[model samples]
Target: MTDSADTLRARLTEAGRVCGGWCTVHIDFSEDRENPEGLAESRRRSVRDRLNRMGADDATVAAIEDALSTPSGLPSPFSRFLLARDGEVAVDEAVPGAARGETLEVGVLPRLAPLIATGVDEFPYLVVRTSRDGGDVAVHRTGAFFPESTASVEGRTDTLHKVKGGGWAQLNQQEHVEELWKQNQQELSAEVDRLVREVRPRLLVVSGDVKARRLLLDAVGQAARSIAVELDANTRSDGTDAARLDAFVAEQVAAVEQRDRADALDLLRSRVSQERAAADVGLREVVGALQQAQVDTLFVDVAALDGETLLALDGVPWVARPGDETGDAEAVGEVPAAEAILRAALLTDARILTATQQATGAGAAALLRWPAASVTGA
Candidate 1:
């Protein structure tokens, strides 16, 4: 179990059931590897400082400190760390290669909400590379493989051909070789299709022998091809340069992520004029749509989260505006507006896209699952 939005939301919901001081920590393990322990200690201090500010009991704070100090028990080298503990109940998981920087938060159930939101936006993908003889397929997210789903296929290659003098014989051998190659391509394509359906990757990367890649692409459905990102480098059954391959894969992933983010922003902008019902711009409107569980996709500006305030009234998050009142409910506390929006989206199962280039003036927008009028009676 990787730390996905659904997993984090489920865990956070479960933690919410137990009423106690919860500690959440986000750390980047990618910095200063030569002094990993030093980084860990620094993050620990940060977490402790936040816990102290929260006015948590000494024993509860101590428990959280002990949990962070212990090993994460993850098999891979994770870039981001998220740990939440409330008394005896604890949930800690490593997010592999997703954290861009270090952050720490200590609060109630949704303290690590930002991490979950960003994890979903990482855009996990599947890469399939095939040749006439065989192929390999693997699922990757934020530069790390899922490991269990990584697979390969092998087939026989025909190398036997007649001499030049035997024209007809040579032609016959060529046809046989072509048949074998076609069969290999079909088999590889089917495997790739199966993985695509199983993984439902945000992007598909295909590379290897030029002819084989073309044949496999033709064999696969158009839907898979639509998301496919073609690469020039061919990976062999016998391993290739590890560093070079890693760099290539990372570059492709980054490209796809940027493209997707741009597309999402474009979609929101395009829909604003012709289909006002489908798009909601600005923070309050987006929050309103989210509260009704009508948002299909949430587009948040990368800097939207910073310095924005939200009110958490009885565990339900509301966007903070001047003179806003809880009415019959009592306000629990204030939280980051971005985190509140993200938590609401996760709970409603809406997709999130963080925009880095284009900024919606109010810092956020949303494409609703239903028309705005239907949800808000506009």
Candidate 2:
């Protein structure tokens, strides 16, 4: 049998590696409620410093910035938050044109155990958490609508404070969660009155069951925020032994990874099928195939050097052979070709990958079907 602690540690270690050497901890407060501001700020600073001590780098720093930025559609930071020693975060400045996406990853920790299990894979906001041995792992996929919010208090610790009033005595965990939510809702309503906040986020990811999600939704909805629950059987009291935590968490991560892979594969198959359909239906060869000029976009890797290319009218890549690049070209060049794929997808209200590989398969890219919404025949 695997040592529970060791298993947890391995999961954490593997998760951290997959997340580009970093993980994230997301502290979710009951909606309309505030973290102990002073406490949280102090903790955030300390965590950031600790992470720096752990040898995190510039990219990690940028990913953190991106996660916290207002444009990312993530939860706005309350009085305090932390970046921690194990990771860095920043805005993806590489997103051509308008920076539309956000990303964050850092060393795995107990705090993010919940989000890691959700495995959302849309807008590049990934939350990773690890167990004690640094062996256990968990990951969450996110997108523009899903933002990462991590909280930590410098001098304080995570402790469960039982609600005192409202006939809540002898209640089960679910009932206790409901009761806590009720209390938090009133508090959040009061807090919202204190500020004129911009970009109030819609989703909230928390650990626990229906009670926790209900509690959050009630509190946050008072301020017009939506919520998403990251289920976790572990409570705040679980010690940070890497192995014990990893076994349970690994199961959740594996499930999420499977779902993400399925979604990506479905998208690829759809694109391929669309191409085939165009060929069967069109009168002109140019209308159906990459050679004909139907492909409007071509997603290639920005990190890789894929030479000069052109986009067909549909959304496909047409690699030009030197002189073949000039004639009838609406969008030209390597960078431009990549950009066209990206922007065209965005323009036609589509999503494309520059890298063809699936995210589960290590490296992946999404190419668009058109260069631009305005591109002729698109």
Q: Which model scores highest in TM-score?
A: 1
In the range 47-155, model 2's lDDT, one tens digit per residue, is 4465456666655544453443323222333111223333443111111122122222343221222222222123212222211111111222222222233322121
Question: Least lDDT summed over 10 consecutive residues: which range in candidate 2?
Answer: 90-99
Please give each candidate's TM-score. Answer: 0.76, 0.32
The local distance difference test score of each candidate is: 0.66, 0.33
Model 2 C-alpha RMSD to native: 17.1
State how far residue 164 of model 2 sits from its true place (Å). Answer: 11
Q: How many residue pairs clash in each candidate?
A: 0, 78
Identify the runs in model 2 with alpha carbons over 4 angstroms from their true place. 1-181, 185-204, 208-214, 217-227, 233-261, 267-319, 325-350, 354-375
State in Å the error of residue 286, model 1.
Answer: 3.2
